[model samples]
Target: MKTTLQRIGMILFMTGFVFSVCAQEMEVTGTVYDAHDKSPLVGVTVQVKGTQNGTVTDVNGRYRIKVEKGNTLSFSYIGYLVQEIKVNKLHLDVYLKPDKVALEEVVVVAFGTQKKNAVAGSVMRVADQSYYLPSVIFPYPREVNTEEYEAFKENRFLSTIQHPLSTFSLDVDGASYSNIRRMINQGQMPSKDVVRVEEIVNYFSYDYPQPSDGYPVRIVTETAVCPWNKKHNMVHIGVKAKEIPSETLPVSNFVFLLDVSGSMFSANKLPLVKASMKLLVNNLRPKDQVAIVTYAGAAGEVLPSTSASDKQKIMEALDNLQAGGSTAGGAGIQLAYKIAEKNLVKGGNNRVILCTDGDFNVGVSSLTELESLIESKRKSGVFLTVLGYGMGNYKDNKLQTLAQKGNGNHAYIDNLQEANKVLVNEFGGTMYAVAKDVKLQVEFNPNFVNAYRLIGYESRLLNDEDFNDDTKDAGELGAGHTVTALYEIVPVGVDVPVGNVDKLKYQQTKNDVSLPKFADSKELLTVKLRYKEPDKDVSRKLEVPVLANRMNLNASQDFNFAMAAAMFGQLLRNSDFKGDAEYSDVIRLARKGLGNDPNGYRHEFIRLVEAVEQLEK
Candidate 1:
């Protein structure tokens, strides 16, 4: 028996050796490129066709991987056609064509307008202009669709291709706008994720630093006649952050509105949320207060508001929380807000920091209802901030609306680093609102420019009359955060839409310049801002004039950065007026304008753009 066993082992060993020798390792190296422009593609996936072995292209669109020589290498990415090639060559350059007509052609630009065919470029020296939380991506198996479940059982399915209809709710409120309403009503939801509400809402930093203009702290405003209802006025406000401050700020009242539903049970869902929250807790100052609110099949305040000063207590509350059951987010929200209201410290920052996967199915399930609820609650002076977590079944649209109406900031915490960025480094600014109900409106002189479109912020646009209505809520300014807005202006000669009124011969045109000679050209755009100190009821207005000189798109860092960001957003949204914008063109423009690399956020933008290009190939 021993001899036979030894003979069998030797035979098996030799067979393994023979197979190993026969299957030589294939060294696959390649450069990913944009099929449309023949540009290099970064972050494109290069995988062994059938196996899990895969690698992504670097910033320069270069990738190297080792696979069995006979295995085929599959090159795949979103927004681009997939390509498969046998591992026969050591060097390969794969060109991915952009799916021009693919629903992926949309961009979430200024004001969250998901326009298709918008042309814009990537900003240079910037971090990811847009990023979805990791939880939103790797959803749990239980959250998988019927088809996906079948594939899971097979245990051989490739990436689960996201359909437009499957994640339709993740985009901007489909029922909010007329066009989207039309599409949704017809049951023809686009399959591509063009304008994700979370990305659009999180794109701009809010205006912070109460009394500073050097940075983007100050909010800018202007008044105009409302197009929808001429009887009412339209108030346009721009939120700007003054400067990134260096201070150990005030105490905080934080109620964590977490979702521990069955959807978040996956390793990347609930587990990641727990780990991420710990990172945030570790950064809290002793003066700050923390509370835990968990919701699943039922809602409960697992930890009453505790002082950040009590580290052990806070940590234990967080540690004790677990995930299970369905989501009763509405109930949890009510409870969390109640806790916040109860622990409301006058003058001290009172905020309910909602941490969730954003999948609210039970209790006030409708987005509008949720938004209306938040709107009423903000009047309590307890601000709301949303920290998103988990993936599959994520409801970004709902959370975005909730935060917007709640008069707070929205952040997608995809990684621990981002958590630190929001919770630790910018703790004061993130938790405390120096200015509330911030609004901006800019009235441009018809002479300086033919036409202009405010990039992004489509959803935040206010009615002209809303400017003076203190009751009309807007955005809140955090401490030392910068808010950027871009205006694509057509020079005087451009055939831009001059007002849509009748061309009356009596209405003075070029001749009016002489009549209003006293009017300074510098005041071409009048910027008005309204805000109430965090604790005050009566709002105050601040006025600034945007001189024609400040319109130097090439000279000012503010102009350059704003333009770059706007262009990038427009490109993503596929705006109708994103004129002649190209990825490489925008990259060049931004590289020149990005004056410094203090935060390395700018550099990250460049990498992300390159990554997107690769993905689009």
Candidate 2:
């Protein structure tokens, strides 16, 4: 009996010990600050040493994480020395010192050099009549030639009597908005050609109903008075792709084709890319596989395809990368695609993610050559995603062309928050395609409308004949992706003068046959869409007719917000069609339509508009 009692006492002692150990794994809180000025540093990455668990510091420099009593916590920030400390208590504060070697680099202005430390009080002016603050040392001015953009004509109004059909591919890219934001933040207006109106409009999320039927996509349309031209009507078309849960998504085989060229040496380029890729790697499932391929003067594989379960190995490979040599973008693409094909997963998501500044200057560097190569490889069922980073000599045009032709999406990561938005928050939509070759063709009823013009999508306009051609490639729709398009319309009764054309003497003119009798009815226009399943070659068609019912600008939050976005784009482009639209009008409308901005993107848009207003003044 005494021995039995001793055994019970022993068991109780062990239980207490176990409970004490478990209690030690409690929450840890900390704050990170700059060592020089003791200012709070935002976006500092805080992670438990030797673990995948991590979190970024808040705007106030505060961070909270869970760790054991003896576990070590590591804090890292760009341009700052990394700090690691053992955790004994719940609260910790760390001050990070700026890397002197990195900070001592000369600040290059048009005239002379300034010490990086002295840049805080100096202003530098370039030959283009733009001023910059030298204090933002990371994205230093490049020694290369000024960046170039392709000049393209904007879409013009078309008389419905002459051309009744408007067809184009759906663009889901949002690169231009972020790129323009970078320029504006740098105290300059972006060049006119850099503003892609369609990209700006599609950047924001719209609230549209999901598909009730089994179709992969849904169409939502509304018409309201045009804010720019009150005499005309604005039609908003939203295409919403069905959302699939991440757990149910097919296995992903990703090849991270990173550019380690000399141009990518900037803080915002390679370092930011590495941090961004780490976030993605942390979120990856064990079933997913990743491979790292890097290019400079030449292309080579840094890591073979491996399961995501071994995240430490993947991250070690990424951390070992350093920037140098010239850019061989074409060779990098070939090798990445080859590796992707070799490890392609059947009935799965296979893609090559290209992170670069888009400055390709070595062999086969021309835009045409790269586009051809990407076009050829896209047939292998491996997609591409072009992520542009850095500034100075960024090649937006080349990166955009590659994404367009390579069955992929394009995004510019200007900062770490933007990276989280693209890679973490919108992971499924950015990485998984639900439909490919999605094309839209709208036929306006001449009896109800006199003239009409697509507000954006100038670069995605497709030939009318290409709409039905299955061989023609087009934009892709990812899971839970929302695409918005706007059209300015002139109703038949509106007294607007349109350009007149000479009658064709070779053709007979029949008014009754040309104009549909049903136009006077509720039917305003017919929207026809064609898309193919991700792995299929055959395309499926869906059509829906829009009603002539007119809605007030305040009728729906989506309508108002979408119109505001469109107006903002037009103002930025300095579009000729902008009538009475001003930046103030955009601000007022946007505020009212900002419904449940959980992600704060709408609020960011409002801020962007305010900035542009100040710039305009």
Candidate 3:
């Protein structure tokens, strides 16, 4: 009895000791303000010195962090001098001073109805001029030119007899389109390397029917006379993914991976990023959950998983982010994916929505390393959403690589209006996926075609055999998304400027071996598509034979619009295959294709062409 009583006393003593330690760790609440303007500064990083534990100032410049006794806290913000203070009491306030030299390094130019001559007599070195209403114009006065894009050669027409099968992945990403749009609107011609013709054409939705055969995606095919060259025909392939109602959409487990590097301090960068994030948060369902992870020279999680119902808290987290330090993109991604996996919502939408300028100067910055890291994470069934921002030093190649490897989508947010389009208006299509690893393989028939070339998708091309391999990663189809692909065809009797393949000893013709099942059919081409259910490993197949259609003078508006976009992209890149493509032709096709454009996006495209025409003159 005496020993039992002594054991109970020891247990009580240990419990009391634990309670005392917990009591000593107090919640420190504080507000950060700019010393110059005396305004509440949003996105101030409030962190415990020498540790990863930190929090960001919210929309109101308020931050709350639990700190142990005698722990020092560091406050940092972009273009602001850092301040460190010891945590003593429950309440604390911080005032940060702006660093003038740092401010000068980041040029702030006028935008959205502002004059070309902006702050501090900075005449934005524009290549052309016509301010787009949705504006994000900043001059790289310091470095002058730093934007990066992967260079790729245009696809060439192949002899139908030698190369009958053309396989490539399907993509719904619109980053290339918007990024170029920003360049053109900023009075600069988008470099050829940055112009992705497929992305440009697929940016706009076509009047294709959704899935009705119990599958998540449907295939629609059409034919029209090539707008650029009447002698050459164009085949239009449209894939429309089924749409789910917003209310019935799967619960989302989102981790907002943000780059808070010094490069993102410009108005159109970090500030725009915060605005864009808020737009997405507004569309989140009550049952959805969100967390935030930030990276500068190092990576840290600023917010833990919190219910979307607590939207105010989420917005606060976004507001508290400010940019400073070098970019650690790889570390940020790793930390974000880890947190997302930890809070995985089984059988639901699990994603890491990374918003960055795509600059990675610090640890794990190599493309090969990031690719391997993302490849491993893709097996975890977590989707990725990459949102590119900023211009000077923007890493387009890295962003595209990450998106493709992760089986995710990419978009560029230039302004608040664009943010609304992607995050609010098109919320369902941008955030949720219905089909994963979508790929298309086209077998052109020699009987109907002499030569053929896929209009775009040079970067998405795949080995023909990879179509059957479920392990190969490909682009994903989001809910309510429509992906459009075009093929330039030279009919059997028609001829175009292209090369012929040399006869090979091992080559086996249809007569030498055996004819394909559809070789004798009247089909112009056979399109075989493969896609996996978002949660599955094995893929399902859909095959459709497209019958040849003689050139049509009256093509559908959807086809016309897509053709216009294709022609515009080709002309911009000065593609050798652009035969007779002209700005006037782009304007004409775009005008004719402006059917039921409630959002006025088509009309805007027409105006953009006019602007480019003026630039050429």
Candidate 4:
């Protein structure tokens, strides 16, 4: 009888345990807001404590997630204090305070700001000083200095008579545009160095006709009145890469070279990277493979190359990552390349996706050293995609150099929305390269155009001789990628002083060289493009001549929008060439030319311009 009673008690206990377990697993919903302003915080990360399962706040700052009643939910934003709430109730609202300590401890610098503790001699005491020091203390501003940018000299107008051929590698990176938007939204103007005109102009998608022919790329050219300078005409050159369907794309072998160093401990750095990687992993196909390689003080492969079919396993590995040690970026690069090459898919998309804050402190940290390392790895037929995160002490120059040398594209991820745009919506273009070693050479007709200046390719400018050299490495064009270049041209009859060069008394006044009759007729310039197949070493050349037909600035929405973006960049950089280009003009042109902004990127850009104008006022 006693044994029977004990069995009944055990049965009841087991049933209760099952009920408890089921009760604990419930759906939790919440809204996150700013403590001071009570405003909804968009893109705030809400994750289950000690787990990778998380969801970001929607436009209204509302989030829903399934979690155990006993588990905790962590709410984190870039500049806000992290908040944790016990999941005891079904609905929980969280108000996160701004992290005042971080804001007060930052020191503003010319190029960028640095943390007070990071700056040398920033906290020196009076005891260490030999001379009297005056101390003036003021209330710390809420702003934190987190932006880092490199200053570049603006391109000046070149006389076609002196230099007729303009050569440059194509650029498809769009990081600068997003980064500038972030600054403008924060009610601050981005530093001059952070504004790359080419990146801004190329950020938007253009309606260039795709190559229906056997060629891998198509070139389109148009000319219109320059928006910035009415006296000068703007030449628009667009390159459209052939679009390839995702299913038909070659199998992918991707190595995620993640930086989990101590510097990446911020909410926006390592945590955001993991979130971004999760988005990418979810988008992977069954035929694709991924490997996780991390660097922190030392480099090691955390997850071996695994098929994308096992997404849960990959996500588990990503969730287990924790940031701590110093960065060994160079070692990490070497190991990642080694793994990628080992599992390389022949005739497939092989690439390394580097997610970091660009803070390389340990071995092989210099920009030149990192460039050499990446350049060496590029020869292995593996491309790179650099996704920069965070801001304080960001090595923008270093990251740009590495991406350029690695034959890859670069982007800055400021939020989950950007991650989705880059890793999810544009996955094919971000991963698969349609053509490699793409270079552009424009030969201006000395008769139709007296002088011309190519804008916003200073870093990519190549020597005229380098155009014909097959061994020279240039930029890579991804599937469905569109690249645009703008040239401010001076007509032959325009009387513009071309930098006032001294007349060479030793040479003939005008060489008796015969000029092509078409040069004086309608041919304004010749556009020549050289690109190689993804797997080939030799390049194929395409050439087209642009006529001297000039149209009104309102010729087409594409033309107007392109020129507006270029003018915006010039205004941001305070280029001397930007004559009478006001913020009002930019807003007017951008709003009118915002064609079918399905993704709303163009509309967002227009809003940013308006915001900047308000801030300037």
Count of backbone clashes, every candidate in sequence: 54, 0, 4, 1
Candidate 1 vs candidate 3: the TM-score winner is 3
**Per-residue lDDT of candidate 4, residues 173-196 (tens digit):** 998898877555433466678889
Mark the regions of model 4 whose C-alpha exceeds 4 Å error after superposition. 1-42, 45-87, 90-148, 509-521, 550-553
lDDT of each: 0.57, 0.83, 0.82, 0.82
Task: Assess the local accuracy of residue 288 in candidate 3 as a C-alpha lDDT between 0 and 100.
Answer: 96
| Model 1: residues with Cα > 4 Å off, grouped in runs | 1-248, 497-522, 549-553
Clashing residue pairs in candidate 2 are: none
RMSD of each: 14.4, 11.2, 12.2, 7.9
What is the RMSD, in Å, between candidate 1 and the native fold over all Cα? 14.4
Residue-level lDDT of model 1, residues 1-617, one tens digit each, is: 99999999999999999899669786777788998888887445566754545555644577767888668887765457678887766788899876554434444232232334343332111111322222111212433211000000100111111100000001111111212211221112322232432233234343222546333345553443322222322223345544434345566778888888877664445544565566567777777788888999888888877877787887667656667798888898899889999988777778887877677778887888898889888988789888765333455567667877887776665444455566766666677777777776656665454455554455566667777788887777676655544444444554543334454586664434445543446445666667777887787777776655443212344344444554555555555545566667556656755666565656656555554554344
| lDDT for predicted candidate 1 compared with the true structure | 0.57
Worst 10-residue lDDT window, candidate 1 = 147-156
Worst lDDT run of 10 residues, candidate 4, spans: 132-141
For 416-522, candidate 3 gives per-residue lDDT tens digits of 66677888778778888999999999999888888899988999999999999998888899889999999999998887457645555886664344655444667
326-445: candidate 2 lDDT, tens digit per residue = 999999999999999999999999999999999998887998898888899989999889999977677888998999999999999987778888888888889999999999999998
Model 3 misplaced regions, further than 4 Å: 1-142, 501-518, 549-551
List TM-scores for all candidates, in order: 0.64, 0.81, 0.78, 0.82
